[model samples]
Target chain A: MTASGGPAVRLVTGTVLDADGAPVAGASVHLADGPVPLPDIAALTGPDGRFSFPVGADGVYTVACRTADGRGARAAVAVGPAGAPPVELRPG
Target chain B: MTNGPHTAVSNQPVEITAPAAEQAVFEGPSEGAQGGSPAAFTSDGLEQVAGHTRALSESVPAEAWTAPSAPLPDIGEASFGPPDMLETVHGPDDRVQITDTAAYPWRVNASLLITAADNSQWIGTGWFIGPHTLVTAGHVVHIKHSGVPGRDGWVKSIQVMPGRNGTFLPFGAVTSTNFRSVTGWTADGDENFDYGAIVIPTELGAVTGWFGFGSWPDADLLKTSVNISGYPGDQPPGTQWYDGRGVSSVNPLKVFYDIDTAGGQSGSAVYRIHNGGRYGIAVHAYGGLTTNSGTRITKAVFDNLVLWKA
Candidate 1:
């Protein structure tokens, strides 16, 4: 369930990894099973292989990196509500 | 390029070229017949609530060929390896044809193909790793068509179609026993580690050539060149898929090049060129930013020393 009545917006940050452990930068991060990537939400990992997204709703959402191109980590992470911790994706 | 903090290199941007899309997909079959376009998949396509996701497919019309180079400036032509013997277009029934060696030459009997969990819809791509082991992009197996959520979006079923060209082989089918995401991908969601390997139950027919793996961390300093090959939809109509090559970018973190890639080109192998040996390092995943009117970026294998090997 999502935390209502709160003014705080949801913040999600995570590092995408491949089967082996490494930082995958410049990967395309999208909200899985939810809103469209373009307007709804989307981000690319920084040089340090990090990404962050703002969320306002709560549900069983999937975060995916569509292609493992320059970015090596191709994973699907789950994001919760405002008070929840960011989901971690383990590429296999 | 020497492997070091990318910032330490001369800030001057090197003259890199992107492979032209027109020339790459020219002689090959239609993209539609290959797979659906990831660039075109829209938000409306993901509107489904929860159910078996629809399989996305697209055709590559011969007319869609854009010519020697793509309309983009930085784009170049697809690189080729040894001369190939592919020459058939659509098969007799208008379906794709299949051949081993000469008429339909391939290094191995197995051509890597991936499928969704439900198996309602399917897409195909070729792999050139181990005989019983096949490789593909993590996204290919993880993301379903309908935007539906599974038990953690894990793939329920995956089949490898070796010697497949729209026809089933007499040896029967090969099912994957175990699937493992390469370690680099498990650690990061970047282009450097976008590869995954699957262990097949048996050998994929008459296995021809097997690519050997090399270590990236062990690679020498300075610019390193590599050859990339796959069924990029650019081979002549009826012949089996041909191969292409590119001088691997000398840059670190962002290894850009002008290789011929399309929807089905994902998971193709990127080889390190060293003393006449083709050492497999990374797998092809996606196109990069456009550099010239015809050039584009390609994501290849990285983190060889780190990827979880079978």
Candidate 2:
């Protein structure tokens, strides 16, 4: 709605832990909004820690992750359009 | 030393490097494998599509797009989404740092078109809709008349650029239209009726102004958090936001926003906040929505739509 570079509204979620913290079952969580980028927008986490994406009209996000025994993490969050304010996952 | 075939291809200065999100749905060339002109992949076609994408980026190793196990949900503790952490850490020569702000302003917008066999390129996501109507995703701008089997798409010329690092702001003077299939219709390039409506003469707030469309919200905006902007030509381009969590639900025609969209994001505009206000609908068209394949599944007149002032 204003995404080609700037104007507040960016939402991108994550959560799929393992390696001491627990919570990693049948993972398939993905999110990409740029042309050709893909984690493949997936969702399969329902033991408790949720996953959602109504996505931005706000801005600032750069989140990345790779699990299922791959072990990876990248972080940055700034979603604002009056939403996106809860995300917590610990364990390298 | 050099000044012949236009100074030897302009003294060999080709090193643009800014289009990698996985080819963003392959723009610029390859319209049905052409036999003549349709090979715009200079730099030797990016070195033969980077040697056919280096064995598919070394056998699917974007870390395999992650997910071994992690869908948290245990009582006494709660998790919404996005927490296994890893949001932009590219460094293995993929090189991603991105930090140039004099006025970032959230910046990141996109809308492309050039097809119907006329040198391939269909990437969308630019919905202003009135001010010169510009909505996207009818397969990224109509295209289905070749060999005519069902046909329901055709419009090649609609450019509304804003950002993706090259920092653009002027490019809008093209229009195309087609969206009148509201029956038991099944398949005709069915991207779930992959919506499309661009009638731009000039007025998307003249550049950026207008956003609001809702209906599929019955309850549970899943994870209830959002934000997703488009315009991707990775390696630190302009706009590419993400913070997913709206894992598929509430389906009348379509509504799935795990964020993550490519091919320039079909016709992106999936925001949330409903009830109190703050809507921004038009959730990911064709970039992702494969519950089936015969897409065109429409039915939401809602009085021609224009609601978002509550």
For every candidate, what share of the true interface contacts is present? Answer: 0.00, 0.02
- The candidate that wins on TM-score is 1
Candidates' C-alpha lDDT: 0.36, 0.35
Which lDDT tens digits does candidate 1 get at residues B189-289?
32333445555666542243344454454234123434343433322211234323233343333333344343344455555434333445555554432
Least accurate 10 contiguous residues by lDDT in model 2 chain B: B25-34
Over 4 Å off in model 2, which ranges? A1-52, A55-85, A88-92, B1-135, B138-159, B162-165, B169-191, B203-230, B233-235, B239-264, B268-310
DockQ of each: 0.03, 0.03
**TM-scores of all candidate predictions against the true structure:** 0.43, 0.27
Candidate 1 is graded, for docking, as incorrect
Which residue segments of model 1 deviate by more than 4 Å?
A: A1-92, B1-105, B118-120, B124-128, B144-146, B163-172, B182-188, B216-225, B232-240, B248-254, B291-310
